[model samples]
Target: MSYKIIVDGIQHKFSSAHFIVGHDKCGRLHGHNFHVAVEFGGPLDPRYNFVVDFIDVKNAIKAEVDKLDHRILIPTASKDLVLKESKDNLDFTFSGKRYSVPRDDVCLLPLPAVTSELLAKHFHDVLSQRFKGFKIKVRIGETSSTFAEYGE
Candidate 1:
C-alpha cells in the first residue's frame, strides 16, 4: 500500500520579491508572503512504519524556503532578462526597465520566471532528489488565497 506524509505551517513560509517578465501589474517589482507545502508518497518502510520522519521533512523544507526569505528572487534562465553582475549588486533589465539589487539580498534561481507555479516545480525537483524513493508534490501559495501546485 502507498502512504503520503504532508507538511505545512507558519514555518514553511517565506517573504520575497519578484516581477514577471511580460505581465502588466506583476511586471512591477512586488513581494509576497509565500507559503509552501510538500507531500511525500511511497510505501512505508517496514522498520519505521511511516513514510519518513516529520522532522526530516520539516528541516528539509525549512532549509529550502529559508534561503528565499526576505530576499529578491532572480530568475537566471529568462530569455527576456539581461543581467550584469558586479561585486556588490546584480543589475538586471527586463522589458526595457533596469534594476540593480544588492547581491547579498537576492536569491538566484535557475528558472525562466519566479512564479508560484515554477517555484513549486523547483521545490519538487529539489526535494525529490533528496528523497529518491518517493513521489513528491509541491504546492506554493503567492498569497493567502492564490496557490499553484506541481509534481505528479
Candidate 2:
C-alpha cells in the first residue's frame, strides 16, 4: 500500500518581493509572507516502516525556503522582462519600468512568472530533484484562502 507524509509548519515559510511583468494591478512590486506545504507519497520502506522521516522532509523544505527569504524574486524566463547582472547588483526592466537591487538580495528563478501557481511548481521541481522516486505535492501562497498547488 502507498503511504503519504505531509509537512506544514511555521518553519516552512518565506517572505519575498516580486512583481508580475504585465499585470494590470499587481504589476507593482509587492511582498508576501509565503508559506509552503509538502506532501510526500510512496510505498513505505519495509525497514523504516515509513515513507520518509518527517524531520528529514521538513529540513529539505526549510532549505528551499531559506533561498527565497528576504529576497527580491525575479522570473528569469519572463518574456516581458529583461535582466542584466553586474558583479555587485542586478538590474530588471519590466513593462518599461526599471528596478535594481544588490546581487546579494535577489533570487533569480528559472520561472516564466512570479505568480503563486508558478511558485508552487518551482517548489515542486526543487523538492522533486532533492528527493527521488516519491510522488510530491507543493502548495504555496500568502494565506490559507489564496494559494496554488502543484504535484507529480
Candidate 2 regions with alpha-carbon error over 4 angstroms: none
* Residues 9-53, model 2: lDDT tens digits: 466889999888888888999999999988999999889999998
What ranges in model 1 sit over 4 Å off? none
The digit string of per-residue lDDT tens for model 1 on 33-54 reads: 9999988899998999999888
Query: Clash pairs of candidate 1?
Result: none
Ten contiguous residues with the weakest lDDT in model 1: 4-13
RMSD, candidate 1, Å = 0.8
- Clash list (residue pairs), candidate 2: none
lDDT of each: 0.92, 0.89
TM-score result, candidate 1: 0.97
Clashes of 1: 0
